[model samples]
Target: MGCCTGRCTLIFLCTLQLLTSLERQIFDFLGYQWAPILGNFLHIIIIILGLFGTIQYRSKYIVVYSIWTALWVAWNVFIICFYLEVGGLSKDTDYMTFNISMHRSWWREHGPGCVRREVPPPTTRGLEDHAYISVTGCMVEFQYLEVMHSSLQILLALVGFVYACYVISVFTEEEDSFDFIGGLDSYTYHHSPQKTSHVQLKPVYLSK
Candidate 1:
């Protein structure tokens, strides 16, 4: 039971990490006006379910968790491929400029009073540059973290898959053992011959 508790904790943490990473990516995509919100929302729900299932130790939940993990793994692989295709981090060298442009465009289109009020330009060049630099650094760090999290998620999912399989095998073995014991007892009770007591003829004659 202690072992199971520990394993559940690990799984929960891994899932939480995956959730955080996904949320971060989703937020970034949303900022850029290109996020798949519904898919990400579904992923979040699946992770939550997995966490609940792990804590409760339910096989059905574990199965769901495993399936989601598998799908997440595939999604991560696809993302990695896409990232590479886009020339990886090197292509993001102009992240600050791109992000600023995206932010401006998004705010212009969606911000409150967009039609009534004009967007304000940066007041201080030095401060603006500094802020963009900081933002760019954070973006770089986030990108690296995203890759690391994806890799870690893959490992976690693999471990979870194996654990799920083990749990299933254990249940199967227990059922088989019970069935065998039950069948053996049933056969012994029904097939074995009954013993009978022999009567003494001498005793009967004396009585007469």
Candidate 2:
């Protein structure tokens, strides 16, 4: 297969996916976002499997990887919706953590150029005093950061899905073509098949 639409391109894409997924996993871990963490874990595993398949020219593994890419695209879309508050999904909620904790995105507190301030809360009748954190000077909002991450993931998954399908088709064609021929390379059958069955030939090419 050619490099542009072949296993080489798929391998490069999968490697890039692995790196980005690992980076996202680290931030998700810091934020204690259970859902994204789990998804990233699975994505990493499948990407490695896809990389192995690409290297070894295994069509079945590529097929599984291709299917996973489609599902991955959907997963990222859900994440984008969740972060953007589309379809009634709220970013302020702990939906990403599966309601296990109140911990929010790390970027909410430590985003680029963001400044966090703590101030006393309003007095409540017979209630304990509390302090609230105020974030300002953020170059970009946290929800947008999350959305961007998901968007990037979606883009990579779509590209990978396309390359994976092409690679699988190429693999299939190679298999079919090999079977159509007798699997012969540079050697010709000058003698009977039984006589040339052994690999202990004098030499593939004669000296004189």
lDDT for model 1 comes to: 0.55
TM-score of each: 0.50, 0.83
For model 1, how does the per-residue alpha-carbon lDDT over 1-208 read when each residue is reduced to its tens digit?
7446555654766566566657654554654523323445666777677667666655577677678778878876654544444545442333423444533112223333333334334665654443321121122334344455457757766776676666645545666798999999998887654322233223553554
Per residue, candidate 2 scores C-alpha lDDT tens digits across 3-71 of 345778899999999999999999999999999899999999999999999999898999999999999
After superposition, the stretches of candidate 2 with alpha carbons farther than 4 Å from their true spots are: 1-5, 124-128, 183-208
